[model samples]
Target: MQSTSHSAVLGRRKEPHTIIIARGDAVRHFTIRPWVATLLVCCVAVIAAGYLLATTYLVLRDDLIGASVAWQARMQQAYEDRIATLRSQIDRITSRQLLDQQLMEQKVNELIERQTALTERQNVIAPIVERVNTAPTGEESERIEKKPQLGTVSPDQSGFKASQIAALWKTRTESLNKTPAEKADLAFSTITKSLRHVEDDQLKRLESLADDAYQTADKISQALASAGLVIDVDYDKANVGGPLIEIDKSQVFDTRVRELNAAFRMLDTVKDQARSLPVANPAPGRPVSSSFGVRRDPIIGTAALHSGMDFRTGTGTPIRATASGTVVSAGWSGGYGRMVEVEHGQGFTTRYAHMSEILVVPGEKIERGMIVGKTGSSGRSTGPHLHYEVRKNGTALDPLRFITAGRQIQSYL
Candidate 1:
């Protein structure tokens, strides 16, 4: 059993081993690690085990924690989605509300601005109207509320913002469950409402004015009623003429029906005002150098009473008619050489003197603003100027008395 075993030594030499590898478009030489396969296998097994565990969990969790966890995840997802949706909706609502508010604010601001403009207009018109013998009251008590109408809107309020309009629509909907598209219709409605509400107050004012006018008419009627003049109320005709044109018959009767009648009867006197003179001058722009009252005479250098104004104008300046009327006198007068007299309607008469040229003939029909003659120092004057005078029924009056400023008169007066 004891046998000598002969051992054969295996020759071993340390050497580097090179491996060749090839890929598309490239070649390389490398050395391979001995444990690479084992490591790869370990990684693959781990992955497989993890997948198996997940699969098992899904299958087994059909009853307890797994299913509950899945359900909770779904619920959380749903909650997130819902939150996103609500946030989007809230943004939309907020945007809409903001837009609406802006529009409404714009409307309010413009409306207030328009109110101011209207107030300014009232100021201008009131002064002009005041100078008239009888003017309608612009007070809330006297003004009739026009029907709500588009035209009545303050100019500044014409364009309303969409948001504001939307808010207004909502309010209108709540008020009557309806809305209107036509601005004019809305305006008309508003005006009508205002007019109706102010009826009593306006009526009282109208009554007061009517009473005053009546008193004026009565007084006029007593003195001038015999002048073949009539101041009767006639809807068919206006004393001034035109549709809706009203005549203050009450005042005509109370103040001076006869005077009015005489004024009207002096049809020839009125005809004179509109006459075109030989030179078409009407004394409309004639400037006043001397006043109508007592003044020192420029030539005499002494205190003297003056009955008229001296209108200083360039030679040949056009004179115009103050009112529509006929030519009463176109000839020269004592101390008022080369004079023309026009009798304007409305109990008004004007005289132009020292005219270098006369463009109109006597008994000529003329309208207000017609040129009658050219300015010149033909009468008693120191320089090239026209002696101008205004008279009401043979009574001299200050020419400035008729110049009235008002919104109504801004365009003409």
Candidate 2:
């Protein structure tokens, strides 16, 4: 009986440990009563295995994350480098100084504005590419350049065709992450093709515009040349490349037009001014000492504003009308011996003071620069000098301002 019981105990122990892994009751329902304590030991082994598996996965996850971050950083750096290069190129092109100073500045301003627009475009497009690599396959990227059915391609033809030339060569951006690898390749290739197309179109247009500009400039320049205006055909130094690409003739001709107009304006202004006034010199040898306004007062103390310029001409120098007008007054006036006043319209008048002799009577019409009398020390009696005065609305104006170059005033004594 003892041997049989011992054998039974061994057999019971040998049976697979029945550790209750399922629950049946509210409490520890299926209580795992270790037949021989082996059942409890089995539970511990399973827990240990699970802990080891979880730890391994955590370590792997950290390493994968590190690599992904590194990739993203590198991509960002590359993109930045490209943007910087483009900006540099744009800057160089915009700073040209060869054209007309004013026009060049305007063009540079325009170029800077366009470059800013292009930069904004790049900023909008760059992030979309990065997100594509992280988006799941079959994902629709929010950044994809979906074109409206504005072209010849039908809706069915418009759908993405990884193998089609047009689809693979254009509309190549994606907004999703975890996208299929093939799509990325396709997107990049298409983008490259698209960029080349754009660059080519722009280059051709630039060339065409430049050609057109040259033709227009040349034509207008010929016209200006015939019209006696010279064109300045030059490019700015700061602008890159061999020449400026453009299509505007007014760019050059306008400058010449402005210059010509300015020159004519100056001539017109000069002609409008009265320079030589009429007066006679009583003394023949004394040159004009002082013309008008404050002098040494011939006897004052402080520096005073000289109202008119002086003409150092020999006495008896003949004086004439500075302009054509009617003599409004001819008589002796205080500090003015036998003076004559002439009125030139628009509220302007000329006065010849201290005249040795008044040749023209009051109300007499006189020609410009006409000899009016001899220079004399008749009034205020200083040596002979015509105290000629120009007045606009009765206010004394400068006589020198009207004096024409190379023409001396007077014919007296």
For TM-score, the strongest prediction is 1
User: Per-residue lDDT tens digits of candidate 1, residues 1-413?
Assistant: 12223222434444555688899879998865657757878999999999999999888876778779989999999999999999999999898778766755665565555456445534533442343224334431233333222113333333466658888787666656434324434554564554333333323333444344344334333322333223342322355544775567334222333333343333323223222111122354455677678898888889887777777779998877756678999987877878889876556678888888998988998776778888888767788987777776887765543432112222211
How many residue pairs clash in each candidate at the backbone level?
75, 46
Lowest-sum lDDT 10-residue window in model 1:
404-413
Compared with the true structure, all predictions reach lDDT values of 0.57, 0.52
- What lDDT score goes with residue 111 in model 2? 54
List residue ranges in candidate 2 displaced over 4 A.
1-288, 291-293, 299-315, 404-413
TM-score, prediction 1: 0.37
Residues 1-413, model 2: lDDT tens digits: 98889888776444443444545664333434455467657778888888888988897988889899999999999999999999988777655323334554564565565456445534432342333224422212321234211112334444545567665445443334434545544544554554444333333333433343344334433433442324343322135567667746334333333343343333233333322222222223335566556556664556665555444443566667767789899889986776888887767777877677788998898876577776666776556667777677887765544442112211110
Q: After superposition, how far is residue 101 of candidate 2 from its true place, in Å?
A: 60
TM-score for each of the candidates? 0.37, 0.30
